[model samples]
Target: MKILIADDDPSSILYLQDMLGEWGYEVEVAVDGNAAAEILRRSDGPLLAILDSMMPGMDGIDVCRGIRQSDTERYVYMIILTSRVESEFIVAAMNAGADDFISKPFNDEEMRVRVRAGRRIVELGEQLRRRASRDALTNIYNRGAIIEILEKELSRQGRSQHAVSILFCDVDNFKAINDTHGHLAGDEVLRVLARRMAATLRPYDSFGRYGGEEMLGVFPDCGLEGALEVAERMRAAVAEAPVKTEFGDIDVTVSIGLATVDKDQTCKLATLLQRADDALYRAKANGKNCITIAH
Candidate 1:
């Protein structure tokens, strides 16, 4: 785990850094509020922070306020280092989004306990976020989370006028599978297809379960040709394998609708998604296991 110590006092910095390091933590340092705030607000910043209450400017309270107000999805657990014991001071710290507090000149044992508590809370928060963002069945991004990712990626690509490709995929004969084998078996097929198709995708591509037996893929900086190639690979990955379930080996295949936004083409997110969906519907109409591209 990483901990950030934001204090202008050299002695305090050295003391915390040395102690935290001894306790198996990587320590990051910032001498002033601006630097501290920048680190804490960054997406990959340390989630555990200890801020001195009386820094030169924009003290710990201000830092907490700024972080809480920022549009970052990362959660930061902040502890305000203060000597004050007044009720008003505690209220102020809590209102500013400090998770906990440690009095200045704190006892060594007290610091260790409080730090561990903060780390546990951070871990719990992360677990909760993962549960909320992931699909319960397939362990892929849930519908809302996947759509959010696609929007963010598209917005990022739009800024650079880079190509963005997407795929809308659905299981072929999924209803028939559920009627013949149990729904549990159908679920197993979905899981198996998700795992295989995900393995075949490029590292940067995003694959998620949009809904039952339907999946969505977002490919940033990938063109139409690349997207179609991936679609074909995904199709083959499912058609070539039999998913082993409690019932038995079950044959499965998928149909895909591939769409792309060229650097020169500008379109709304809904339009692109609908284009892919339309293509996917056409692919299913033409044949069960096939890929179709949207012009």
Candidate 2:
């Protein structure tokens, strides 16, 4: 894990850097509190931070306050390093969102133990986040996470003016599959189909279970033709192979509805999703196991 050290004290910074380095942690140093806050704001930056209680521009408490207010995807575990371990100061730090605190003239063994605990907490938070964002049965992204991905892709497309497309795929006669076999058998079908559909998509493409037996796919930089091609490929991948389940081998197919956002279209994430959903309904109306492009 990457650790951010924010302090104005040169001697303390050097000693702590060497100690943490020896402990096998990647270190990022900030001479002032403002710099440390900026690093924390980055999406791909460090998840663990140590901030000096009194630094130029911003203090450790101030940085902790900013971190707590920010809407970051991942949780950041923060420790406030203070020379004075007064009761009021400790209370203030905790109120400002410091997860832990370390006193100055810190003992080497104590620092190691505190940091070790912080690392465990950070890792556990990430594990919970993954579980929350993933589908329990298929182990793919869940509806909320996929919708967030779509929104993120839409924002990226807005900046780059690159084509972005989405597909709404529904398992054809899914309820019937559950009725004919059992819910367990239906679950097996969904699991097998999720793996197969994922195989058909590019590594960069985003695929997720959008609740029930419907899946959503996002294709970045893909126009109408490319989206249609990928959709057809996924359709055929499922139809060509029977999903082997513990219950039995079950034939399954999907109807796909594709929506593309070109440079000319001013669309929101919800708009794109609705268009794809409408197209999916049309595909089912015409026939199952086919692809329909939203006009």
lDDT for predicted candidate 1 compared with the true structure = 0.91
State the lDDT of candidate 1 residue by residue for 1-295, as single tens digits: 9999999999999999999999999999999988999999876799999999888768999999999999888799999998898989999999999999999789999999999999999999999999999898888888998899899878877788999999999999999999989999998888889889998999888899998899999998999888888888989999997899998889888999999999877778999999999999999999879999986
- The number of the candidate with the highest TM-score is 1
Error of 2 at 47 (Å): 2.3
lDDT of 1 at 141: 82
Candidate 2 Cα errors over 4 Å, as ranges: 8-18, 21-31, 54-57, 148-164, 198-206, 219-241, 268-270, 285-290
Q: 174-289 in candidate 2: lDDT tens per residue?
A: 99999988999999999989988888888779899998999999999899988888898899989998888777889999999999999766698888999999999999998899
Each candidate's clash count = 0, 0
Candidate 2 residue pairs in clash (backbone atoms < 3 Å): none
Model 1 misplaced regions, further than 4 Å: 9-11, 54-58, 83-89, 157-162, 200-205, 221-233, 236-240, 263-265, 285-290
lDDT of each: 0.91, 0.92
Residue 51, candidate 1: Cα error in Å is 2.3
